[model samples]
Target: MAKILKSTDLECFQQQGYVRIPEAFSPVDALAMQDFIWDKLEEKCSILRSEPNTWDKHVTGLNKSAENTIYSDIASQRMCRAIDDLLGEGTWEIPKKWGSFLVSFPQKLNHNWTVPTNHCNGIPWHWDG
Candidate 1:
């Protein structure tokens, strides 16, 4: 059965770029997913040590993991459902640009290292330009 998102959920998603769907996954499920990703990272490490050329060829290790990971179950189901509700079914087939989910680990900075200035890439200016 498909879970119906409430009006509040829609409003929150509209105002903010994203919204947190509470209790979307059980604690056990979330932990399992974390373990799954960690296992993939370990596999990547092992592969890289055995075959350094493979690592160089593929910058992101996600492709290997994506194939092994079960999208039908776990976290992906919730994301797919939300996307369907917001964009309508089969919207994924449409050619969209600049949409991705990224996860990064924060690194501790040394005394000698200073914070670097970063800028957001602006959208293409049509009328002004």
Candidate 2:
């Protein structure tokens, strides 16, 4: 059964350009997904889960072409329902209609880096739709 959205969900999406569903995915499920992504990354990029030093970029999952909708076979039901409720029934499609799986692995291990504070407040060109 699809989970119905509260009025606040709609309001938040309208105001913030995004809606966050709490407790939609369990921590165990999330870890499983991360494991799945890691497997794919290792398969495609040869980056082993034990070796974090090999993980150069943030991306770990496949780019997922628009022509293929096979990923639906693996998508979580909760996610599909949430997207459908938020966007509309049958609105959730593959990369062509919806979007790709952007699995980003955060690099948190101790490293010499500094957050850049000086910046011109503007949309990054990559996101300048």
Candidate 3:
């Protein structure tokens, strides 16, 4: 059922533990979702995309809106197939709604931000797999 039926992709997944699937969903849909997130960030955290000074925090958290149906289109059939390829059939559960969104910003030089020397100090380094 996987769109990436080719073994090369599977080999990449096996070796790297992740594979990128291009154009799983429409680009316009992705942009819409991005705009929605930016709007929420500005609304909730006052983190304006237009202002770089507002982007102080390295990471920001935002809650997902249940009423918005735009998030639903992200998980296309192609994406599901890719998931199936990686995780195997019926091994994964489709999300009912997007729970949370974490936005990461670049650390500004002016900010008193110290790079984490140890793993547990700040953002812990780890692989997804």
TM-score of each: 0.52, 0.53, 0.73
Show model 2 residue runs off by greater than 4 Å.
1-3, 22-32, 58-61, 65-70, 73-77, 89-99, 105-129
Q: Which stretches of candidate 3 lie over 4 Å from their true place?
A: 64-67, 110-118, 121-124, 127-129
Candidate 2 lDDT over 1-129, as tens digits, reads: 646567888887777677776655677766665676677778787778898777765663375542344344345566667777887878758343434457555677686875555546753323111
* Candidate with more favorable, higher lDDT: 1 or 2: 2
Q: Find the candidate with the highest TM-score and give its number.
A: 3
Clashes of each: 0, 0, 0
lDDT to native, each model: 0.53, 0.63, 0.75
Error of 3 at 9 (Å): 3.1
RMSD of 3: 3.6
Better of 2 and 3 by lDDT: 3
